[model samples]
Target: MRVLIWILLILALAIGVSLLVGNNEGYVLIVRPPYRLELSLNLLLILVVLAFASLHLLLRFIHYARDLPANVRAYKENRRIRLGHASLLEALHALSQGRYQIAQKSASKALDLGEDPSLTALIAARASHKLKQKGQRDYYLAEAERLAPDAEVARLLLQAELLLDDRLYSQALDVLQQIEKIEHRFIPALRLELKVQLRLNNWEQVLVLLQQLEKHDGMESWQAREIRLQAHQHLIERHGHNLNTLMNYWKRVPAEDKLNTRIAKLAADAFIRLNAGNQAQEVLEMSLTREWDSELAAKLGDCASTNPQKQLQQAEHWLLSHEQDAKLLLALGKMCMRLELWGKAQSYLEASISVQPCAEAHLTLARLLDNRGETDAANRHYRLSVQACEDNK
Candidate 1:
């Protein structure tokens, strides 16, 4: 509708101009010696309008021509950016799909195209690592670090994780330490460090990491608890060779952990091995007071305390509440033997055999019988002990 109105307006203006020109009796004349020129004013006006329009068109063409090269360059740059972004996306998809080779290729292409070079390099590194191309992985990781030094944490985290997966725990630990220097409270880094420390048998560091993970909610409570238990157990074993070191380590153990049956049993056995029978007895008694365990009760029998009478009294006291517990009965038999109460030891050993018929109980009973000059009974019990051991196996 606007175009039709414009057309009518132009036609009307043309008609008005033609009428006015036809009515006008005006002309321009020029003479230069022998040459003379004459023209109507209306014709001159029309020529001037055409000249202005042509000049405007020429200027527009010149402006477009001057900018052509730069415009082309900008267009190519934009195209490269778009293509690089597409390649990056393809790399991510291929990586997620487990196509490591394709992902690495695409990410490398993206990196060459200069699209988020650091991110592309990291992606390529991950893919290379997955492909077990250690050389390429390290190269890409170095590129990532060099390209974006401000993202040191990211590069270090990836490097640590890859090293850990390769079971190069010491290398992973070094990388993790670098990350800690940059960002002390990174949860993922801490979790990775935990794994590295565990693999390295750095129980002390494992405990520290576990504490941080638990505090940050980076690990499940139960999972952290189990790891903590393992760390403490290993720490105990690590120091078990030296009596002073073992005692110092045990003293540093948290009171709550000391009551755990497994930890207590391990500590007790370690103490017994170091000839610290009193300490072993103390650990067992403390753990048993918290929670009863048959294995712990059985282990208690091996704690050869200096005060045999006192230890025997403790085992007998336990027997009052655990009359049917086979391990407790065995412990009582061993304790009675330690105190040289042969008749009581024989009764307790027999009772323990009646309850569970274990090889240890039978062997203890047979030893007691043999000491009393009952060769026939001792022989029969020895055969039963062997059979029991075979049955258990």
Candidate 2:
């Protein structure tokens, strides 16, 4: 349809030109300095039109010729950019599929073609690391850093994460601390720093870093508890023999966290180490009231006081609520034996064995039986204790 329209328009133009030119009966005269010329108007008009057309064609050719180099350069640049983009996509795909060597080649190609050279170099670094080409990976990382000095934070973070993955916790910590100094409490960096501190047994720093993480929602509540538990256990093991230092550390912990079972046990044991029986009793009792733990009950039983009967009564009170808790029975048995309540000690210890046959409970019962001069029964329990300890080992 477009072709037929163009043909009709061309035919109309031809007919109109023919009528106008065929009836022309005019003349043209041109006088230059050297000569005068005269011609028919139709010829003159056709010659003038042809001259203008020729001039337009010549000027157009000159314009195109002048711009040729620029246009070619632009075309080459566009093609290079396209190739780089395609190479980048291919590299990412290969990296995802664990084709490290292919990814490394493509990333280098992208860098050579000038596609965000710094980022591509980092990609090459990652690919090299995946291929276990440590030298190549280090070269690419250094090249990336050189190409984009403004990307120091990103470069450092990646290096730190890589160190962390390699279990080079001290090295990772060094990098992360520098980032922390500059970036100031970046959440991801803080998380990494916490792990590093924990790995290095920096208990005080672990607590500090965890608080920082908690402030930024970098650590969950349960996760904070778990990490804190590990930190507190370590601190307790280190300072438990020093009464003043242990108390100072315990006081620094928040009251709500003091009820944590593991921490409470640690505090109680530390207090027991310093012969602070009442204080140890208080820590254990405080934790038990908040959350019932059988293990804590057993530890509570070990807190000896001058008045054993009173302590026994206090432990026995828990039995009203936790009737069949074996650890509670063991705790009661231990206290009863301490007070020399022979029959009651015997009953609680045997009941503990029925509920949960623990080696420690068996040994305690065996000693109580020995005190009662029941040699054969005591021997049986002593043998059971040895078997249980071996099984546990």
- The stretch of ten residues in a row with the least summed lDDT in candidate 1 is 206-215
Q: After superposition, how far is residue 317 of candidate 2 from its true place, in Å?
A: 3.1
Best by TM-score: 2
Cα lDDT tens digits, model 2, 1-393, are 999999999999999999999998899988996999999999998999999999999999999999999999999999999999999999999989999999999999999898886678888988988787889988888988888888878778878877877789888988987887778888888887777787789999998988888878887989998888888999988988888888888888878779998899889988998988777888998999999999899987788877777778778888999999999999998888777788998999999999989899999999888988999999999999999999999
Which ranges of candidate 2 are over 4 A from the true structure?
1-8, 14-49, 132-135, 163-171, 240-248, 266-279, 306-310, 350-363, 374-393
Query: Model 1, range 235-352, lDDT digits (tens) per residue?
Result: 8888999999999999988798899998998899999999899999999999999998889998878999999888888888888889999998998888888888899989988999
Residue pairs that clash (backbone atoms under 3 angstroms), model 1: none
Error of 1 at 67 (Å): 7.3
